[model samples]
Target: MFKKIDFSFEIKAIGYAFYFSFLPFLFFVFQFLFGEKELSFILLKQMEFLIVPFSAWWIIFLYHDYFEEGGSDLLYSYPLKAEEHGLLRIGVFSALYEILIAICCMFLIVRFPDANFFVLFIQYAAESLLYTSIGFVIILLTKKVMVPILMIVAYVSTEFLTEGSITPVFHIMSFNTEPLSLDQIIFSVLLNGCISVILFVFGHLYLRKKTDLRLF
Candidate 1:
């Protein structure tokens, strides 16, 4: 199963994604050098907000490569089943994304030893999966890379407009300031994880029945 993955492609993708993901951290480092101590907390919060959208955008952008003219034909002609290929692609990207998140959390933890970043890491994982599933469904249904990009823009816009809402269903950025209880963490994991599973299943089933590969 692992042999099917294009490690070169995955490595390049992860490199690029991490480059963008760490931009804010780099900025914070510069600020800290300039004696802005408070930026550390801000940097942590920035990562929490950035991880989902950045990972989502990267996943959607990478999907475009598969749909390019002759690339689509060649990719679809692979010996593996479509569902297997789809799942592998998602799994690889998701795994790399989580690894990047983990690295960021580790950096923050080293700088702020008292901070409980494990909770934030768990929440980020669930949110990342949620956005990835949403992106997968959009790409599968529309077969257009731009559609997912526009969908993300609209979703982010809506999220900004409703940032004050406490309901988790309404806002992906609903992580509270206080430490989350065990029950709260479990509820969040289950809610986002279930939605991710449902969307992935729907995308896989859709791909099984899909005939057209052209984006237009």
Candidate 2:
């Protein structure tokens, strides 16, 4: 199970996640150094927020496609079980993304000091894990890359319509000045944990039942 992911795949995900996250950092530095127009800076920040989620989304799919596409055949021929394989994939990808978000949040705190960066950062990390698992579940069920992309579009569109304006991607929920009470934080983490478990279970079952299906 531990051997399911190749070093090449891990490197690719890590590299892309770090590379894309630099958008916001670069935008802030450019504005501070060159005195770019306010509107241009705001636009760059918005783009950065939108692009961050795609890093995790793309990386999850890359790992899945890299392994499940051809690696599955090799695994079946070995002694590894499907459930173990699925769990290992989930563990690695999720860890990589959590670290990616941590690095992004460090930049965010340096850029925006008015907000409770930890709370918002935690929320963003939770949501990223949830949506990433959902993305994997979609691919496990359908094996089509377009499914995840379309789902992301729908998600962002819904956020835009309901939120009225998109400031920071973390601002999808209303920004709270008061610190999140312990109960609130615990409940939120529990809720996200449940959702992640559900997605993992669904993906595991889908793969187990359709182990022979050809996927792109």
Candidate 3:
């Protein structure tokens, strides 16, 4: 399994994940040191959940681009087919980043003992999976190098537009203040899971069918 995989790219993806997870902490520190308005511990806690996974999506998109450029040619050349490659990529990239985000959440919740741990984890996990799918779709569709920049713009704009309320397409469940009922939380997870699976399947199909050597 490991022999067929591009382990170096996996390491690089984990590093990208860490970079994204670190940004919110840096922002919080800067806000605390410079700003006159005292922010609540809850707000800082919320920032960690909100920024990290979204940043992870950005990193995921970049990694997709890297792979598209034949960055990990060894995987394509090895005995592994596209499905195994996709599975390994998702596993390695998502697992490491999810753990990093989870640890960040745990540390923040330790500071604010009153926060709901399950709710926070569910929210972050849902958003991370959804954004991962979005990244997958972006990589599969656009051959242009500018797609990542456009994707970042689209993500921010969608968040701005859907700043409140839940939807099938756009919802920032991570930063929402309301404590969700069990059904709503389950629905969010299910929805994200379905989408991620669809995107992964579609991405693999795309790789198999689309034979544009110039693109991938």
**Judged by lDDT, which candidate is best?**
1
User: Per-residue error at 106 for model 2, in Å?
Assistant: 1.4
lDDT per residue for candidate 1 within 1-216, as digits (tens), equals 788778777556435653575565565455445645555655545554555666666566555655643345644566767656577778877888788777666766666666567775887788788888898889767768778868776776665556645334555555454435456677777788889899989887777666345332
Could you arrange the candidates by TM-score from highest to lowest?
1, 3, 2
TM-score of each: 0.78, 0.65, 0.69
Candidate 3, number of clashes: 0
List candidate 1 stretches off by more than 4 Å.
Answer: 9-35, 68-70, 166-169, 175-181, 211-216
Off by over 4 Å in 2: 1-4, 9-52, 63-75, 114-117, 164-189, 212-216
Question: What is the Cα-based TM-score of model 1?
Answer: 0.78
Per-residue lDDT tens digits for candidate 2, residues 1-216, read: 476567585556435543554565455455545654444334223433453445346445554534545554544564655675566766666676566566555544554554355764666666666666777777666656677768767766666566635444343332232334445565666577578678878887776665545332
C-alpha RMSD values across all candidates = 3.7, 5.7, 4.5
2-93 in candidate 3: lDDT tens per residue?
56556675556445543655666556556544544434444443453445435445435444534555564544455656656565666666
- For model 3, what is the alpha-carbon lDDT of residue 124? 68
lDDT of 3 at 21: 53
